[model samples]
Target: MSSDDPKGIAPPLVELPISTADRGFYDGFSRQVTIPAKIIVTLIILWAIFFPVSANETLSAANSTIISSFAGWYVYLVAALIAICAILAIFPQTGSLRIGYAGEKPEFSRLSWFAMLFGAGIGIGLLTYSTGEPLSHFSENPDIIRGAVQAQSWDAVRPAFVYTFLHWGFAAWGTYALVGLAIGYVAYRRDLPLTIRSALVPLFGKTMSGFGGHVVDVVAVVATILGVAVTMGLGVEQFVVGLSRVGLGDWLLNPDGSSSLPAIALALAILVGASTLSALSGVGKGIKWLSNLNLGLSFLLLLLFAIMGAGLFALKLLGQGIADYIGHFIPLSLTLFSDEGPVGEQLVAWQLDWSVFYWAWWIAFSPFVGMFIARISRGRTIREYIFGVVLVPSLVCFIWMTLLGGTAIALELNGSAGGTIVNATMADQLYATLAVILDPGTAFAVSGMIVVLLMTYLVTSTDSAILIVNTINGAGDTEGEHRKHILFWGAALAAVVGSMLVLGGIEAIRITMIIGALPFSFVVALMAISIVKAICYDLIRKHQGVPTTAVGVAADKK
Candidate 1:
């Protein structure tokens, strides 16, 4: 072992070289990583297109098997990830470690950084689920199913927010933070590529440079595509609903009230086309501009709720929700329900649909979102990155859920909505609640604004994913010159969402995402272990008067 090896415990900080060479068609792509990932994604898209029924059934069966077998594993893994984030942030040694070279400043301003973070991280979810999730939970949650509180009653409110906050809170963002922290640490300090395999260096070391690394990158690419496809599928459903509400056309919806396949295809085309263009403009310009715009619109929408809706009730729910969320965080995070009896089956099913599904989605999404977080989060300490990436966005989600979802619940309680908000389709709840709160003209106007906001969020998310996938495929090169690659991935993403929507609507997308997330979840667990090991070893190196930070290491080499 070298002198820096320290009893052969610390893995050598060797940079794994990833090649991006010109194959005739796949020019500027990593042959091993990009080719395999493309083959897998293309096969899935073709399957969903040609054999829709078979693909749907297979996805459904696979989702069932995974959920039933790995529900507890998912729960504990995510909870442990959150715990790892907490430990990293609370400890002085790890928390104070900069994400980039010493003296490096943040690339984006705090406002822009936060806006992009929200937009790329969970903006679609806030719009898609802020009203729907809490309202659904208000009607029935694990607590309600267990008879701890009556459904849709005053007693249901706290429990509803508990589960809502649980899904959207630290646990969700911690998944992303841990991945980002790992990648940023490796990429900046150790001079490794900013890809998923880099985060596993401390664990697998030189093995990451071979087929093992390519497998990790391929999994990340596939997971990112499916994860973003889920968001796109759901967003398109709500986008169609918003269009119909704004007097666009009834053709946007089928008779049974789902988004029509034609409408979904058109929306996907528009979104992916726009996203491809924005991605060509690169992260610094197009994404930042759109993120800022959507964040402003989000604030406007939230302000409308604060003005016209039940502000005091939402405020009260916010306080109690935080308390209940804290009190029940442990149980909610780690609890696993058995599918043994009627009540047990109901609880387990609920967990699968809500908690487990959210965990899978976030884990799958971490590659894209986590890499985006790391790209924008250079120069910040681990504590700051955790706070900004996990805590702040989560608190914003809580406030959003309280104000929007709380309004829907309050309207139901007061009978002003007459069950319309609760009875409407999930995609239609936000507009339904707004109509109940505002006059028809005002509701129509606000609905138009929401559609615009939704469009921006979708564009931001799609573009960000396109860029991140390209980054991984190009071995972490973020150059904006790869327009062809961007366009190809954009079309691929559109095809994925469109074909899946045709196959089984959002359900197909959800099942595929859950399945895709499973493999990557194991990767994330390894990442958590790798980061802890790296940090501890670096601290030991520091105590032994060796260089640890990027600057120190660079200077020592000189």
Candidate 2:
């Protein structure tokens, strides 16, 4: 083992608290994720841009069939519970197992940790869906869906929060957290590469050295690129639409949502331009600053909405939302209703569209997220990592939605924020609804703020994903070695998002997500198995006199 190699990667090492290496596990786990991530990511971006739009329809339809076909719906229910239980089996108050490299500590601070972890994972989704979802659910609330109550019952309000929790709760976060934990354990604790194939090390052991490992790595990267590309595409569209509502430009005004293709293309070009500029500036200076800005905007907006929207009611709903979340959490988390009633049907469709879709998205993006998590979690403990990675930001996001979304629901009900929100679908109308409710002379000012917030978030997401995917592509190691590679993927993401907007819009991104998600589910499943195996191996090392910490493990590698 040496300090530097052909890929600019330091030589592999072992890290645990113990002294001896189980040669089989060590060798397999020590193998590298050697591939050009941005190259494949760029190809997928080009494909989305140039590929026929007809596939969007086919993919969407297939997504419908595939998600519904999951063992009468209950299968997904069962799967969620299984995932949650498995992860907690190794729960630490802080960090999880990791494979340390260089001088990197795999863990980050509690607050900084959540900002990056949650922001990288779902910040885009939070902005896009928060208000829009609650308002929509109020139209025909969950009590109606559950058959336990009617559409207009107060129960309606409870179900709005209940179903919201259902969509974003353990099932979704659990999936991402597990993948992250696995990658962290294998990479920092065992000194593995930051690639998906490395996830297989705990199971395949020494067999990962040959073509099999490369094949695994390739699939993981491809699935991740497309998955993330679609997200970027969808996010850009929603952002553009939101900006348009606030008077950003004529580029956003496509009444048919069709005539706006050229505008969307222009929008894509701008994002590409900005992403390139950010990419050139490097991660610490440009990307991190913008990410912090985005986070600040989100927090500010939440504060304003809480002060102005429904005030007391908003605060109350957040508390109640948590209660609702806790009470209905397990049942909702694992629910798989086969009743086939209108509510049941609607719930099923929403789950497919929202929950299952989110699962697929996270799975597709797991390698990128997992790689990033592992990189930051070098010296942290299992429990602390889980808290930041799962609980901290999620609770923040949940409260944000509650305060904002709950207020929207209240306005619609009380004739304050108005019923216009109940009708808005695209994200911009979300703010539009808020504006009308607040009805401040500062209405125009608020709109301007939201538009700016959208742009800031877009920058953060694109750069982080770019830097992360580049690391994966650059053979699972990131640093000065992958700057050009990161820029390539950044530009590609803009291209894909732009093309999709021209071809469709949000519809286009949804299509890509469905198709990309299918294969990635298998990847997620594989990761699940690999993690279980790693935990087992960890126990053996802990009990059998093996070094389990990074310093000890690295010492043995010499």
Candidate 3:
């Protein structure tokens, strides 16, 4: 029962005595958050409060400038790195390696594992971008704009779908997989804490437990909070749009056509309340059920869109998009424009808005979604993890994007809705597309279903993010996660979203997302290196006829 006991139990490193002065506040979830992390989080909150718009403008400007300057190289490099990890995981030497011990089977069923990964990995992002991304690309992708008039016509539709898939497909999920593989291998296979810093143990060794590791974990916590907040804030905006689409009227819209404050408050209240309850219920029940429900509802919605919308056009577009995506994959993956040419400048501008933004968004998301997937992915092989986390989700997103986005583009091509679907706000595009395809009653019903689905997806994402942040801040105590921690994070998320709504609106959400992701991109690259280092070390030990298991490695070190 002592603090240093090694029977699968450990106690706190220090205990405090009652002070003479009584602040009388409870500390329910400070187990693993170092003093430095607490200070950083407090400072960030204070900064957001005191100078919200300035923070937004400063971060946004910095991010935009940075992304614009190095976008060509940064975007292609990340895409290449993710693809490399996926390729390496497919090799016979590494593919079959278990995430856990030699004979351990996966903790969750395949269905549950995939559901959770898909739910957490994409969540409302899939809903938000399915229509918006493709439409945006169709209207003015770099290639289309640079080409002749034909490229700007209906012919660009296929290319538009291709680019959208490029953003959401293998690269996106593969980014998540690389991070998860590193964390899962280190945590489950090597018996380290399930913190982001644990992925660096191979590189830093003992230093991972010192200042270096604390910085890594603190950066991860901050990234996860801001990343999830961005998603939540944007999702709430879309939720309000859905409300208006379903006859909730101008109550959800401001006089100036912005989202109403009262509407946002109500949306945050419901989202936070539901997410806290789900987080308290733990992953096995509440999160799992919601994820499954989300999947089912999403499929149903897709089916309706396929049948009621432009089915033939979407199918045609899907085929062409896949072919185009494959054909252009190499160029798209590696191409980075120089500043010397007009087209190059346009490409950089395009990338800063689309590709670079997405890369940062996904990188920011990796710490949370990657860790969440790794938690459910115990005992899976490297091959299974890579395929499940990367390829499968990419395909799902591709199909969803095709069905939703393809239908919208086809409507515009046919001159049915003209520029309305294309000109509508990003948050309103899906509802606008729905209006084109379905009758008023049907559109209202479908919008309602979407709202419900969005609600559940939001809750699933929020709760999972809460749990992931809790695990990191609680010193990676997965099994003994505190409910009070969930409550705290839920409230914190609501506050962040509410503050952004009041202060900088959508711009604040976007700015924080990119800024939070900037530091973590370096962390993920290091994680990839750490994974390679660990695997190489394992292979070397095996060749030398030394033990390579976690216990054996520890013994060798000792």
Candidate 4:
């Protein structure tokens, strides 16, 4: 029923007719959503497996076109999402609005909440890129390309972090925060299903309950799978490399040093198996414990670098990098270089490779991460959720990049590593850095620790993703007793990653992820608009003295 308001005033919330029924294998699943999503994902995986070269070439071409055509869109859309989040947090009326019903408290402790947030959102990324990204940018960024700084020199350090922080900072998390806030606001406050389609109620109304809704959820599911697959694919590569570094044998490596098929298969079997079991255990027990453990291990690793690596240099770089990142945030977030000439071409290509790629990756990844954040973030105020989701993890990532990547750069500067760290593959840079900074015995021991940590991160990320995917498919029935669905998704995810790696290595995964992210980016843009509209309408209801809180309004109706 509509609230007692003027004819022109909108209802405080619209409850959609979302339905899920028991299917034989997919108990509590929304067949409309899950069936199509599975079909599309299966088709892609089969294409890659059956026609490897064709799939790789098609994906590459599609990736190039999307980057060239939509680079500016990705840049501006992500930047705007961050601005939207900031506005919601700063505006007193919206900021103070709680995510859940009145008087409700958070379901998770602050530490647990933060741990899950960091672990699920960017855990694998930090391990994968902390050393590689910074070192790559330190050697050459847009500033270096533009002749504003000398590569690998003192002049390059600040700019290196400027770009590194750009990729991992607020913009990345803002995408997640906006989506999470939108879903949480409606799902928790208005008692709607916690699916991607629910966030679009304000924009589409009842249309979101029908074919339109299924389409939205399907797109989200596909995006989530591809997004998580890319991360898993990257993690598997690092996992295998970590295995080789710790004496797992050259059988894990090919003649050219890439991961062998056996390595990929073994990594997937372990990761997916662990993740599936964790997903079956639900978010509270398995996911929470693993997140906390990984957080602890992460701190231990960071402490190792702080004690034995370039502590002073990393500290200095941390401060300067943060400052430069803040100073140049806006220009970097919005600027899209054009293809004018050789230099322009280089800048555009770099932006496409780095900034645009990161934006797409974050967007693709946002559905899973955002939904997970929303799932765990009940009872938080809009302000708290935005800040907690966007700011905290980002700062943590900055510190990680500075400490781990800064150590590598410092070693190179001081001639201790003599380019060994930089020369190592992106997946092996962390090991190389550890080797240079620690004694042989100590390095081997720490490398073993890192391998374990990487496994935890990979498992945590994969399990969290599998849970989110099933949540969407189940029409937001997060606690559904559907171990079969979880198991199926885990296998499917492994297949996707394994086939893509076999097809075109990590490059194929990257290309496909970028393409998958494109459609969801549009969905996210709509979510931003819908949440703003819903919040604005809620403010109007508050002013008019209509009960705006879900619990209060429900009591009145009773």
Ranking by TM-score: 4, 1, 3, 2
Off by over 4 Å in 4: 5-10
CA RMSD (A), model 4: 1.5
Which ranges in model 1 have alpha carbons more than 4 Å from their true place? 1-14
Q: What is the C-alpha lDDT of each candidate?
A: 0.89, 0.62, 0.79, 0.89
lDDT-better candidate, 1 vs 2 = 1
Identify the superior model by TM-score, candidate 1 or candidate 2.
Answer: 1
Tell me the lDDT of model 1 at 164.
93
Across 446-489, the per-residue lDDT of candidate 3 in tens digits comes to: 99999999999999999999888877765666776367657877
Greater lDDT among 2 and 3 belongs to: 3
CA RMSD, predictions in order: 1.8, 7.0, 5.5, 1.5
How many pairs of residues collide in each model? Answer: 0, 46, 0, 0
